[model samples]
Target: MWSGDELDLDAYLERIGLRENPLAPGELRADLATLYAVHRAHTAAITFESLDVLLGRPVALDVKSIEGKLVHGRRGGYCYEQNSLLAAALERIGFEVTGRGARNRTRGDSLLAVTHAVLVVTVDGEEWLCDAGFGHQGPREPVPLGRPGADVEQGKWTYRIREEEDGVLALCLLRGDTWRDLYAFSPQRYHPVDYVVLNHYSSGHPHSSFVGRVIVQRPGDDVRRALVGRELTSLHPDGRIERRLVGPDEILTVLDREFGLRLPDREAEELVGMYLAGD
Candidate 1:
């Protein structure tokens, strides 16, 4: 039996706004279209956030808690939690999914923490890279792995990828005339135990920004919305930017309205207080 029995697959899909499975029960195919649909729905419905870490609570990466937090609890999480939830759902729907880690060059140019997580999904002998935890600047949909595309801004910021030496692939962000490296990873799969260690450092270590800050993001077709502490930003595809400062009292309101999350009032207050406390 699929591990999905531990989670309400129907409810999880519903939570992600997929009212009904486009592919039938036994007819589900692990094709690019299906991957794209699920990837898009997940990024749109479930947010990429670090609320639990900011609250100093242990972030759970197990399938059960990941499903519970995103589905019934109406919560969001960072890389480990978000991708775990997506991996579970995809596996239940007949996809061959393997967890992979990226050296998060976006945060720092070091590989000390292989922090970012992405799923390597095989469909018809081709591996597709799928990620739902990359907050605002991640791929808007599943992209073909190894055979990276360039200047492909389909409801996402401009990004490109290239094959690197030693069997690793590098994903980059197009910044003006320069392409800045965002992350690098090989196709080697990761186990759940690896995430446990990384999650500890990401949520507890003093140098990790996730520990003491408020960060939440959800991506859309025309724009991206994110909250870093009191600041709210709306990034448009047409080179337009909109920014605002959200007050502490209204943090919960913004999270719910813009990010599609409804955390408890008390927990919301605590997270906001920690963010306002500053480093």
Candidate 2:
């Protein structure tokens, strides 16, 4: 429950590379331009990570703790923390934002639980689907929820919104010649406790990907950077790709140098060592 005062708007704006303005949400147009700038700036600024879960660090989604870790401490988080922070920042700017949880259909199983958070932002009666938390395959701009089949291109990547007969909307990314589902979401708003439940499962469950490996990602100039366990991938604009496996000794170096995350040296060493050993 963000009361709008929990997040320091000035600190948040500076962290996300936006200038602080006294304009209220009503004062600024919720048009595509404003949405795009904010969305891009945010995705560009923060890394999508789950290192705390690996290190047994208590992850809290409350506004105060979120500000301390992400905005102030300069660490990153997974879906819940990322979206919660994004929503708070949006509310501060006067965007009519609602927190919604979605099933990750990217793995091709519709039976998956609601583990991802997204925002349905309304401005001037028009609603757009926004999720800056989706790591490498996420949209850099908002997807107009009204327009199905519309494609959003970032560099060489193409994304679209697929609406099913049951009224569920799935964000899809084109992979090679096929369209891959990113996630399935609905219009229903979710409460804060819902995320607490999902976050617990995501962070603690042995079957969850977060617990199984070390995942880190951050947006680059025209590339999207992602590190899965020891594999680091750099997806480029023209579809050319570069891939490398980081050695055990260089785990923290890769995380810090590439992802801009500076976990304590001892913790980074132990967490990565533990993860590899467990795997």
Candidate 3:
């Protein structure tokens, strides 16, 4: 059930260019799934970068700020910004969405509030987990919760979900015979402030990857590419990076050309110089 206070349905429908209200419960199940797919494609198509931090600007988490980035022809964002916008969209389309916190497996079990925003949907007497954030590990479709084993696909990857203690859930990928942890969460409710605190850490913590690295990723009609600290790799439909880059000079060109990212002149110079120094 959606209320005007929780979601601006008109604005959300307009944002997605859907003429009818999507959040009407009966139609919401499929509509919400469609919205998640739209968000995943939208986020994947746009490259992630910390250019805002580089420009000495703080990232905004509101709907206007989020819609502007996606619609106003600007760069895509990291998890917090990406997932928040998706949550708003879901709410407007008539899905019951509440913000929740997840302990990122990569960042260790730190319980950092709601660093990620995920959608919980009730369909046919069951709840499901829907996430279009998490970059490489983002869920392409909603995975059924309360299930012993469930499979969800995003791009070329398949994720498996397993039940944990109490209501907590663990999501992982099947790596041959072994499972790899991506992240874990529960149905715990959270507020916007939770995301605010985590976003602050993600952008400011010295040990955080975003603070120390320049990462950008984009997907074309046929290929998806990522640039991490001067190395660029383009993956094909077969999940192979046909081209592997080795220098900063190439990274700059790829950021601008491949990802539509505009780096500051000084930052570009510093990166190129650092790459040349072989550090």
Best by TM-score: 2
Give each model's clash number. Answer: 0, 1, 3
Error of 2 at 171 (Å): 0.3
Per-residue lDDT of candidate 2, residues 208-275 (tens digit): 88885778987665787899877899976555668998877677778788887887667777876775
Candidate 2, superposed: residue stretches over 4 Å from native: 20-31, 237-241, 275-279
Better of 1 and 3 by lDDT: 1
Indicate whether candidate 2 or candidate 3 has the larger lDDT.
Answer: 2
Per-candidate TM-scores read: 0.89, 0.89, 0.73
Candidate 3 per-residue lDDT, tens place, 1-279, comes to: 222245444444444444354533345444545655445544545555655553345877776776666545455677777667667766665556666677677565565543555656655567777665665445556776767576665555566888788878877864344566767788687666677787787777776567756666654445656676666777554535555655755757767788876555776777677677765
Q: Is candidate 2 or candidate 3 better by TM-score?
A: 2
lDDT of 1 by residue, 168-269 (tens): 887776644566677788878787777788888888999887866789988777778889877899867554668998876777789888987888878977
* Candidate order (lDDT): 2, 1, 3
**C-alpha lDDT of all candidate models, in order:** 0.77, 0.80, 0.62
What TM-score would you give candidate 1 relative to the actual structure?
0.89
Clashing pairs in 3: 22-93, 23-93, 23-94
lDDT winner among the candidates?
2
Task: Rank by TM-score, highest first.
Answer: 2, 1, 3
